[model samples]
Target: MPGSITGTIVDPTGAAVAGARVRISHGDQSAEQEALSGDDGQYSLPNVTPGPFQLTITLVGFTTQASSGILRSGENYTVPQIAMPLATAVTEVRVVPSRVEVAEDQIKAQEKQRVLGVVPNFYVSYDHHAVPLAPKQKFELAWKTTVDPVSFGVTGAIAGIQQAQNDFSGYGQGAQGYGKRFGASYANFVASTYIGGAILPSLLKQDPRYFYKGAGSKRSRVLYAIANSVICKGDNGHWQANYSSILGSLAAGGISNLYYPAKNRDGAELTFENTLIGISESAAVNLLQEFFIRKLTRNIPNYEPVSP
Candidate 1:
């Protein structure tokens, strides 16, 4: 003769839990029997084989419950009422920006940076662990620099000084001479800015921005700034030779020979000399940036200093 198992399921509040699944397994090698709790929270497993048996109760939104007992032939095994506890709830959240998106945001912040709120200081990054810019972003920065009002003003000043010194005597004098000088100066600016800051940097997978090292000894900072002229951070975030800026200076100088007077063009010699001068100028500017420029720069973000 077979036995039967019965049980009642309830929630923590002692309310009958309907639709709960109740299963009974015999200790012997026999199939398990299961039943659903009724509206009264009652469940029955009829015709279960006699012997040791286990009952398991389960419901959605509540923890599973289990009980064990032995049954005699033709016995009615009544399991005690099982009270199920509410299951613990869990949630997950994530909000991470892509590399390009992060770089774009950093670029927007950099564009707002100006020395004394007037000169564009867009090339420098105060964030030492700044993300690398895409090629399009590199060109965009170059374009912004070339079109800035201060860039034109600076180019005009350079032309005035050149005209006064008769440095490019080939251009002659008066307004026409000044106009030519201005055009030449502005051309140099555009070529160098695009070639070095955008074109070559994009090709060489290098970054053109000067990363500020605000946390270090004065000697170390100075050396870091000077060394940056010859070596720069690659897109991979590793330091490498700055072929972009070097070759860019040479390329820009060679392009100038086309517009410059025949007497003023020194060919490859002038190109190499100009490249060296550009590197020296970069070192000087970087030194100023490391020691003095940040204090004068406006709208700079409060970024943490990188490890020395």
Candidate 2:
């Protein structure tokens, strides 16, 4: 005798799963029939044969489902609603900024940093693990520092002191002497900045920016700051001997002979001496940066300090 089977399909969320294919077959019989679920998720096999039967439901993007039951003759067999589990998505997504873009953003932030809201503190990077700068970016930073109005003012003040003290005697006294002194002083600044801060750093693949060590014991922080004057982070993010700075200072000092009054030009021995003095000054400045500069600096980014 013929019997009928009926059921509804739904998703795990309990929403109706429309258009699911439903099939039924009698045990020990080759006959099989199929029906699709409607908008209401209902499926029916009205002409199914009586006795034991197997029912299967399948849908695209969902796990196939099956059930078996015995149907009495002419019985209206009703199966429980079939819940279909959707297949897991196999897609992957990844988002990241390019290296150049990341470095550019970091440079923009660094350029805004100033000590006491007036002095440019662009050479220091509070982000110890900063991205490496490209050659172009290194040059750009050096150029910006060289042209800053504050830099010109500082150079003028130094030249004034030199004139007042009658230093660089070859240039003598008067407005002409002051002008020569000013030009020579500005030239020294430009040469040293470009050579040490940009050109050598780019060629040696070194980071020119001082990495601030803002946390740790006072002694350790002091040591870290002083050490940074001689040891610097490389483009590969490892500490290395600061050949860029050392060599750049030597180069700048050697170049200074060309522009400065011959009497002021330090010979090889005194040039080396002056280089040592410069390095000591760098160490002192770095110590100040670690202990005090950030507090006084305006527009500083909030970065967690890195430990040695």
Candidate 3:
């Protein structure tokens, strides 16, 4: 086929369909062509052989249509203009998205999707470029997680485990002892999450959520998730040192000294050690995020569709 078929395609409203798939077939064999319609509804399928053929047009969310005609050999055929009729009016209405508003709404929705249908999973945003939370919103999320009923229940469970394991033996074994351990565990979760995941992140204008980099080699994804612990996305949409995470871990550890048994409490050296431990914990969590959490999480939202 040394020649081509050239033509224009349009909808009833005369709007060019940019992504329309055009397929041509002749004889028992077939040939295919795809051309993006120009702004003015003009499209050209260069090097199409001169022959009798059929043009098949298709687009997503649209019905398929076809036209047949004969072409003279070596002819630059300008087929009759093809106008696609509206197949159906979909009742599904789509809203044009505003990026900032969409991110905010997504965050608000996530604040409600809890683990165990109770513990707030507010901090885990699926969006990589989520909008920065306002100061009040940050505290509100912290307060919500701190006071969640499941949080208290889980603290009791940990306290039970700790009692069985004699983890903080200085606290001793009794209802009173269990209460102390429970309080300490809950306090740790609250302090670390609020300081590292919320307050300092808000203050430093860093996103606390781990950005999922799903498209890459396994090694790259592993390194990306691990690197996220030390580097974070800033409000300026750039990567920088994760001051919020580092300082927050240290602050949470330092705050533990106020409640933990002195024997269990870290002196400044222990505080730094615990801070390192927290950073390591964050990397482990991010690794789980990269490979596991998305599967467990339900009702994952769709990304806003980018219209061409």
Candidate 4:
């Protein structure tokens, strides 16, 4: 007849300890045998040599436990349940960056992005899980964009084009006309950028930056880009109507009339038309951002998608 050893192991809380290893050694100094605890925390070593023995139970995250007993021939020796204490060794460490610090880092990376390393592309967030910008940070970004050298150069170029085309003839073709056009163009840029991208965004707690949707079918991406002209993410992370952008466009257009020649003033209907045109332009720009601009942009961050 052969003897066998059997027992159940448990945690200090009395819950069964699965996957525990039980090693048994005889008092005669014979070789040891091992068995693994089942889901029920029960372990059995069949045909164990009959004799006094010691059992050592061990698991990865639990303290080792031991028991000793004598076995009779042909008997099923069931030892008392073994209790294991949780291991005190350090297992894992996690360091979470502060939200403000994270947003600052993201802003630093975004500030480095420029089209062809020249034109600032500061209004788009490639990170889908980007943190919301603080009000002060929002104003800082608008200021940087307006004052970048390329902005002035672009405004000058636009004024030259308007001069060549004689778009605002009441100003008359001359150096004076160019200066007036340039001032008006730059004013338009500053007002719209501050009102929409900084002031309104801060007040409404809405995110003014366009969020890139990089993963989708071509048609879906295109539609999403276009839809973003009318909808934007709120600071609360929900999508809502883009009231800041729409109202900002209208306000900038209205303000432009005050500085432009009297003959060039936009009527109420024309002002609304220009607003629609601005929205359309936003859609077009978003489309380019989705499919084209990132490639041309320098120093963009390699952001990975995070789980919601």
Candidate 5:
């Protein structure tokens, strides 16, 4: 006499698992039959000369389940609904190497962060889900900023301001001084930017770009930006002490004192003092960033996970 066994396969979520491979074997007289669960997760195997039997089910991304049971000949049987545990996804994801490709995709997305449809706001990542940039990526972004035409234009404006203030008297007044100041100013910008934003950041294993936290209460946003100037995202995509900014600012200040007039020079003590001032100044700027910059600017991408 022949009997039949019927069962269903489902996940812990109780979702029907179609295409799951179900195997049934009974001693040397084992009969193997496969049933793909329907959308309803129902699988049925019929016409078995039942005796001592074992049932197993396997699915990709799922653990295998095995059951041993006895069946009486000529008796219809229903196995209790089978529940297959989910195979862990972590190990499978770890084996894949799409990291660089993922970063490149993110960088491409970041390159579009602009302001008012005109100004280059490339350094801002609207993505709260950003990945750590590779060293080469850091340099690439720095090179992009350094060579940007807007960067040169902005540097020219700073040079004009320095000449207006007679900031570098050592170079003397007029066109020569203006040109000298321009070179120095541009160099300063480039050095500080590349060193702090790219070179040193890559070396120190930091992330140079500002991670936009465009949410929370007003006070929280203010505090967040201020805290960020002294603490920054690491290359591992974590927030850490911003040694790169503090040291970069100090280095730039000391180097600037070399070219300024002796009378105008900030001494070693003054340099250190200036570095402190720089940090404070950054806080002020960060405050403005938290409170004002977004409004003054436009065309900012809306990839920020939430709104402030």
Candidate 6:
């Protein structure tokens, strides 16, 4: 004679689990019986060979469960209600910004930086691990610097001084001379800024911004600042000779000869002299940035200090 097995399946909340698979197998026999739980979660297997048997219950989105028992011939064995726990779901998420996007964000922060809350300090990167800028960003920064009101004011001041000193005497006196001097000065500024800060840096894969070294002894910081005048961070993040600034100064000086009074143009001599002066100016400005400018700069991000 054969026996029967019956059971009800439920969820952890005790609600009926319909359409769940219920399978019964005997250890001694190679045969198995299977059934699907009804809408009320009831399931039954009739005429199952009686012996030692195991029941497995399976459903989507729930853990598989099993029960075991020994059945006597012609007995109706009922299993305790089986409750299936919900399966734990696993989900993975990843978020990452591209290098160009990161650089653009950093540039936006830098653009807000101003010295004494007035002058733009856009070329300085307070973030020690700042990402490299693309060629388009380089040009954008240069354009911003060139169009800044302070840049125009500084150029005007330089022109006024040159006019008072009669520095380029061939331009003569009065408003006409001042106009010529202003135009020449502004042209020089535009040429040098774009060439050194944008064009050459783009071509040479160099960074034009001065990276602040905020965690070091005064002497070490000073040396770093001076060295940076002739050596800059490469796009690859290694320090390399700053050929962009060096050559840019020479090129700007050579270009100035095209407009300057012939008497003032000293050819190659003037070019080299201007290049040396540019280097010296860079060193001085870098020193100011390391020691004093950061304190005076507004809208600066709270960046971690980098060690030497």
Question: What tens-digit string does per-residue lDDT give for candidate 3 at 136-243?
Answer: 666767787778787788889999999999987889999989999999999888888789778898878887766667656778878988898899888778889999
Compared with the true structure, what per-residue lDDT tens digits does model 1 show for residues 62-150?
Answer: 99889899988999988888999998877777889999999999999999999999999999999999999999999999999999999
| Candidate 1 wrongly placed segments (more than 4 Å) | 1-93
- The worst-scoring run of ten residues by lDDT in candidate 2 lies at 23-32
Q: List per-prediction Cα lDDT, in the order shown.
A: 0.93, 0.91, 0.77, 0.91, 0.78, 0.93
What are the per-residue Cα lDDT tens digits for candidate 6 across 1-308? 89899989999999999999999888668588899999999999999887899999999899999999988899999999999999888788787999999999999899889999989999999998999999999999999889999989999999999999998999998999999999999999999999999999999999999999999788899999999999999999999999999998888888888999889876797689779988999999999999999999999999998974
Q: Tens digits of per-residue lDDT for model 4 on 1-308?
A: 66998999999899999999999998666789999999999999999888788999999999988899988889999998889999999868898988777888888889899999989999999998899998888898999899999999999999999999998788888899899889989999999999999999999988999898888688988999999999999999999999999998999999999988898899989999999999999999999999999889999899763322
Supply candidate 1's per-residue lDDT for 214. Answer: 89
lDDT of 5 by residue, 1-308 (tens): 87878777889988888888777887788657666677778777788767888888888989999877778988888888889998977744456657777777777766655556566666766676677888888888888888878888888999898888877678788888888888888887877777778878888999877777778888888888889789988877677999988898878877876666677777789888877888888778777666766676665656754542
Predicted candidate 2 versus true structure: per-residue lDDT over 27-65, tens digit per residue: 567588999999999998887777888888999999999
RMSD of each: 9.1, 8.3, 14.2, 9.6, 12.2, 7.9
Clashing pairs in 3: 3-48, 4-48
The runs of at least 3 residues in candidate 2 whose Cα sits more than 4 Å from the true structure, single-residue gaps closed, are 1-34, 37-93
What's each prediction's TM-score? 0.73, 0.73, 0.62, 0.68, 0.64, 0.75
Which stretches of model 5 miss by more than 4 angstroms?
1-97, 261-263, 296-299, 306-308
| Total clashing pairs in model 6 | 0
Q: Is candidate 1 or candidate 3 better by TM-score?
A: 1
